[model samples]
Target: MRVHKFTFAALAVAAGLTLTACQSGEDGAAQGGASSAPPGSPAASAPASPGGGSSSGGTDQSGGKNSAGTGSDGKGTAAGAGSDGTGKAGKCRTGDLEITAIDSTVGGDSDGTVAVQLKNRGGQDCTLSEYAGVDLKTSAGSLSAKRTGEHPGPVVLKKGKAVSFGVTYPLNTSGGSGVRVTGLVVTPPDETKSVTLAWPGAATLPVTEGTGSPVKVGPIGSAGQGG
Candidate 1:
């Protein structure tokens, strides 16, 4: 009887030990799973959180860099546009003009007028807003013509177009007492360079920059126009 009881107790103790070992292994596995995701698991493969991981953070940084670059390019383009807006054609120069004495008196000498024409041979358009300065070349000295009209408005001289003005001088009708003019030196408005052109008509016994009133120059206009 005693031996049977002892055998039964030993069997029960062994069975209890096995049950405790199984329970301990199961608890350790559950704790490991709850603490962190294992490698190659679905949780480990998921994308990073908004503010945390390498993948999402790198993408956001790249987007920020692109936005900054775009802003810099936009500023440069705006500055270039401003610079181009201020670029306009300049005034006409003497080297760009073809100057000539077109017509003069046929018979009369006193109060005689000469038409001076200026054509733009410059490849581009230019502005001419005032009277041209004229000087009659003579044996005595150069005679400057006085402006006769009011202030003229601005006019654009397109390429290949022409503008004209009149030069009026008095003649000494007395015998051999008049100024003898050979040529003219014309200076365009607001220009420093000059152009020389020969007098269109007779050189002797007629032309004189007036003694009483100065020789008169009319405002700029089209051909056959002006005072």
Candidate 2:
């Protein structure tokens, strides 16, 4: 009986050792297998951690692209709309105009350019479709600055601005002479909206005689003459 009990105890000890060895071998195999896995092994495929910022990061990138596209498109559309609006508004921005200065003096022995300055006392721009014919009154027979056509037609001037038109004239001789320039309102292309200025005399300028230099018609008793 004592021997059987002793044998049984030894068998139990051996079995326990064998079990421990098997468990150690299994653990070693598992560790080695895990270490040998490639960089992108199934173990590397990790789940999104709690509080991770990847979701927000992806959202930020996707949203950034969409937001950028939206902003660019909106800017482009706004710019295009502004341009179109400005163009349309410009066509209607102009108003009526009147002649301010008409100096018909010549430069020298030869005919020189006649400078006619028109000012917009009104709030808008004016377009003179055609030049109204006028005999620039001179002490001598009136010199003609023939209105071949409208001067500076289709000119769109800004408010309180002045525009200039030039006409050439021959100075027969140099002398101080008073001349009156006339202008008549006209509508171009259509030719139907014409307004005749029966006595609407343009500003007067005096021509300096011998020098053929220009002189100005100024307030009476004023020192200098208008050129």
lDDT of each: 0.72, 0.42
Q: What is the C-alpha RMSD of each candidate to the true structure, in Å?
A: 8.0, 12.3
Task: Write down the TM-score of every candidate.
Answer: 0.58, 0.31
lDDT of 2: 0.42
Task: Write the residue-wise lDDT of candidate 2 on 25-66 in tens digits.
Answer: 899897875545478865455445577633333443543543
Q: What TM-score quantifies how close candidate 1 is to the native fold?
A: 0.58
Worst 10 residues of 2 by lDDT: 216-225
Error of 2 at 182 (Å): 7.8
**What is candidate 1's lDDT per residue for 1-227, written digit by digit as tens?**
99999999999999999999999889989778553678888667768676565353334454354333445446522222212244445678898888888656657455667889888898877777778888888877787888887676866777788888788776556667576878888999898899898887445445434474356788777335321
Clashing pairs in model 1, backbone N/Cα/C closer than 3 A: none
